[model samples]
Target chain A: MAEIVSLADAVAELVRDGDVVALEGFTHLIPVAAGHEIIRQRRRDLTLVRMTPDIVYDQLIGAGCARKLIFSWGGNPGVGSLHRFRDAVQNGWPEPLEIEEHSHAGMANRYVAGASGLPFAVLRGYTGTDLASVTSTIKQITCPFTGERLAAVPAINADVSIIHAQRADRAGNVQLWGLVGVQKEAVLAAKRSLVTVEEVVDELEPVDGGIVLPSWAVTRVAEVPGGAHPSYAQGYSERDNGYYAEWDPISRDRAEFEKWLERTRTTGVPA
Target chain B: MSTATTELTYTSDEMMSIAAARALSAGQRCFVGIGLPSTAANVARRSHAPDLVLIYESGALGAKPDRLPASIGDGILAETADAVVSVPEVFNYWLQPGRIDVGFLGAAQLDKFGNINTTVIGDDYANPVVRLPGAGGAPEIAASCHEVYVIVRQSKRSFVDRVDFVTSFGHGRGNGDRARLGLPGAGPTLVITDLGVYRPDEHTSELTLTALHPGVTVEQVREATGWQLRVADELARTPAPTSDELAVLRALKEAS
Candidate 1:
């Protein structure tokens, strides 16, 4: 039987300094509450890894928690500003960082292959493109049968994996119908696992007659209904599309983050 | 409709022209990209492709985005989307299975053969400058889509004799070679720019302008290109953008 932890307590316990943590949700599907807790806790010198990046990474970088970030796409949603990330990439930041960009499959298959304990996963996605060299951590191989050359990407490993889900049972069976890529991989890759969920069901209540992610992989579950607000999970209200419509007020410039930290609520503004 | 006009009426030709060129068929499954391609795609979705299956590289399928996304990582693409699958399943299942009818793109650099370079702006790989977006699924979409459409602003700097690097895959080594690579389907079928609509000649891979936008001339188009430009004998006039089309597109941008 796993003990239920509060959202803040669960996150603070999982994340540590100098650890690589992968967050769940693509772009903005899931909220960045878990990482936000660490930022509030003022954890420093953290290395981050992701397949694709968005505003949350910018927030993490802005909060001065992230030492390095690894991912493919990096930019503010539409506001065209992310002061935290800009400081690290365009300007120099306190931490040393390296960026590994590749196609979605090139990054993902590598994790799948890694979790399976394979040396490298073959993919035809990155041939002749700069992704092969930029993410040189990924290699190329020749098909013994077809004589075709393909991409061989290495697996991703992290110290802790923090993910937010639409719903979870007390047993930690997870459910997320939309954009749950590598959630399992991030869980398997991390040594310590933590989950942020909307609500806790009694037991085995089928979302669509099935489970999205199971209990064995889930170590911690924190129930926070309406927590993923502003970041829609479908069937929940529509995303706080307006929040992103305007450039995140916090990410406008270098000093903007000072305002960002003040405005954003850790437990979501006492709602 | 009053003739007095309004402040919102854009007098400049550039914004209107960009708007008109991006109008696409509604309800198409577009394998969308970032930057100009994303702009054009969102415009298309707002203007005409309302039911468009806007597939972002992040694996959001049929995304009903309320605003124009600045990048692929916008939550609007996923949270508001109809369905979101794993990174692998989105590409391997939806895209490679031929659900994507059109792949929309733009380029930093191009050659006569239609190859694109979004990787670097300099000459060498190991030590060149201007490391670009580094190809995020553009290659697969370019190689496998039933048809690919490109929208780029014509400029000498962009239309190069040879690409500085390969970002999105197209016309792999010229006519018929992409087919040889078992790339699954026809390569880039259309290159749409502010100047005109260009297609790679069936025999030679040279880009030949077929339709020039109204008020655009062959010389003006050439001035914009980096390569020695060519035009078809019968250059068709691109249709002008209607007021309604411009209205929807501008509103869409405002929302984004």
Candidate 2:
């Protein structure tokens, strides 16, 4: 059964040093508050995983919390390059960071395989690309039925998976709508899961195109309103595009990023 | 061709976007990347290709946003979509099965053969000069979509003879490369840039400059390209963007 807890408690209880953690949200509902909490707690050596490692991951990476990153794309969405991520990879400013990259299809399928309790997943990807050369996780396999050659990727079973949702019932049944990207799979694929919701409701009135994660599937739920700030929860608020654009300059310089980090550290729950 | 009659003033970027939009036909299912590709796809839908289906990797299918989306998973995409699916389903069931008609992409760097490198700029992978966002859906989008179209600014920096890394394979060494690699899609049939338009040579599989955008000269295109570019025997001038296209494109930008 899922436990209703505070964001700090959830991070302390679920995330640990050197753990493979996934905070999965595509371009919407990113668990920014939870990422902030993890940073505030000073957790280190985490293998952070996500499809698109946007500003949240950039913050975590810049704060020197991550030891490795497994992701497809790492950018500031509409704005530009993720300066902190670029710094880590190019110069190793905070610390020497390692990266294991994959295409979106491969990463998504890896989560699917992990959720399905499978060893690997197959797809028609990376055939002529150099991604196969760089990443060892991508391999070639022959189909048993058709004798066709295909690419195979190992399942990504994270130690802990975190996500932000629109709402959750008191019993901790989480519901998310609008661009529900890989949150369900990421939760199911992890040994433990944490969901930060905009509110804890008496009941989740069925939302159109909403995905519900049953209490039993999820480990914990924390009510942190506006948890996905900067990145938004569909019905709750709008994506702060200006903030994303503003982040470029702050993150560009090392001293400015450090100051922002300090401010984030000093701030409370909804950092 | 005479440039006497057209009086409207527009940036080369606008012309590039309009030309890229013109490539899409109505009813085509286009897998769109964010930024330049997304802008072009939305422009096409609003103008010439009304029924064009816009698919975002964030799992919004047939997304019809009134304003341009800042990101692939913008709430507008979901709210306006015909159906929203999980990320896995978007790639596995929709894209991997060859259901999408076209894949529109943007590149940080591209080679003469259309190979893309969105990974890194420097020679060393461990220590790169500039670290770019790695491949999102471009590899499979390049492989599985019935055809691929690339939109990137033409420059010596972006248009290289050889990409630092092949983030998405276009044509490896030229003819029969994709076939030999078991890639299914017809990779990068058209490439639109600020300078002009390029189409792959049927026999050589090398991208050849097929048309120039308005007043852009062939010499200018050559200078912008990193490689010794090839030109079509009967190189044509791309028709200037119509008033309707400009109105729609400007409206989209203004709304965004």
Candidate 3:
């Protein structure tokens, strides 16, 4: 059975130091609130996993919560670069962060493998690129039936997975729509999962092309309205495009990023 | 149609987008990266290829964004998409299976063989002078899409003899390379640039200038490229953007 808990309580209970944590949302429903809570609680040495690793992951890495990042791509979306991520990689500011990179196909398959309880997943990716050279997890295997060579990557099971959704029922069956990434897979693959939603209702109408995680599958549910702000929650709010444009300059300089971090730490989640 | 001599003023970037958009026929499923590729794909959908399906890396299938998507995962893409699936489904089911007809890409650096580098600028990957966003879905899209069309601004720095790092394989080493590696799909069929358009030489796998953009000189293209570029025996000047093409392209840009 899933329990309805506060965001802080959920993060404190589930996330720990040196734990592998996945906070997923493609472009929508990013769990920025939970990430902030983890930062506020000062969790360290976390191996953060996400497909894109946009502003939220940049925030987590900038706050020194991450010891390593496992991702396919890291950037500020429409903006230029993730300065803190670049700093961590190029200059080693705050701390030296390690990276395990994969293509989107490879990362997605890894999560699929995890959700399926498989040791690894095979696909026709990374055949002619340099990623296989740097990423040791990607191995070459031959198909038993056809003798065709394929790329295989191990499953990624995390200690805890966190995500934000549009809504959930009191019984903890979470429902989300619009650009669902690996949240379902990430949640199922983790030993424990915390989902933050805009509101808890009595019932959830069936969402077309949406995923519903039954109560038994989820560990905890937290009501954090506007949790995926900066990122957006479809039908609930519009994406604050202004914030993304504003973040580019704020995150560029080390002093500005530190100053912004200080305000974020004290101010709590934005409304 | 306006006479060819009557000048139509548009930026080279706009011209590149128009050229890239024109390559897609109706009802082609295009796997698009953000930036120029997204712009080109959207333009095509609005202007010529109304049925063109735009599949983004965010797992939004047949996305029809009224405005330009900021990134592959932009909210507008999902909000207006025909259907959305999980990230794994996007790669494994849609992209890896070669369902996409045209894979549209943008590159930081491109080589003679059409191999691209979006990873790093410097030779040493460890200590790169400039670290680019690593491959998102480019490797698979480049491998499995039926054909590919690259949109990039040509310059000495970007259009190089060899990329610092190979992020997406075009023709690999040469003619039989992609097949030898058992990789599927025909690698980059067209590379659209501000200077002109390039098609891979069937035998050598080297990109040759098949058409030059109107007003762009062969000398200018040569000067911009790092290597001695190969020009087609009879290079055709790409037709100027039609009035409708320009109007649709401009409106799309303004809406975004």
In terms of lDDT, the best-performing candidate is 2
Q: What is the lDDT of residue A26 in candidate 3?
A: 85
- Model 3 CA deviation exceeding 4 Å by range: A269-271, B1-6
lDDT of 1 by residue, B168-248 (tens): 667766777676666765767788776778888888767888888767789988888877777888888875566776776
Task: Please give, for residues A1-271, the per-residue lDDT of candidate 3 as tens digits.
Answer: 7899999999999999999999999878899889889888889999999988888888889999999999998888888788888888887878888889899899888988999999999999898898898889999999999988999999999999999998899899999988888899999988999999999999998877788999899999999999998888888977778888888887788899888788778887432
TM-scores for chain B, in order? 0.88, 0.98, 0.97
Ranking by TM-score: 2, 3, 1
Global CA lDDT computed for model 2: 0.93
DockQ of every model listed? 0.40, 0.90, 0.80
Give DockQ: model 3.
Answer: 0.80
Candidate 2: tens digits of C-alpha lDDT, residues B1-256:
5656858889999999999999999999999998899999999999989999999999999999999998888999999999999999999999999999999999999998989999999888888889999999999999999999999998999999999999999998898998998888999999999999999999989999999999999999999999989999999999888888999999999999
TM per candidate comes to: 0.80, 0.98, 0.97
Provide the TM-score of the second chain in candidate 2: 0.98
Alpha carbon deviation, residue B98, candidate 3 (Å):
1.6
- True contacts recovered per prediction: 0.50, 0.93, 0.80
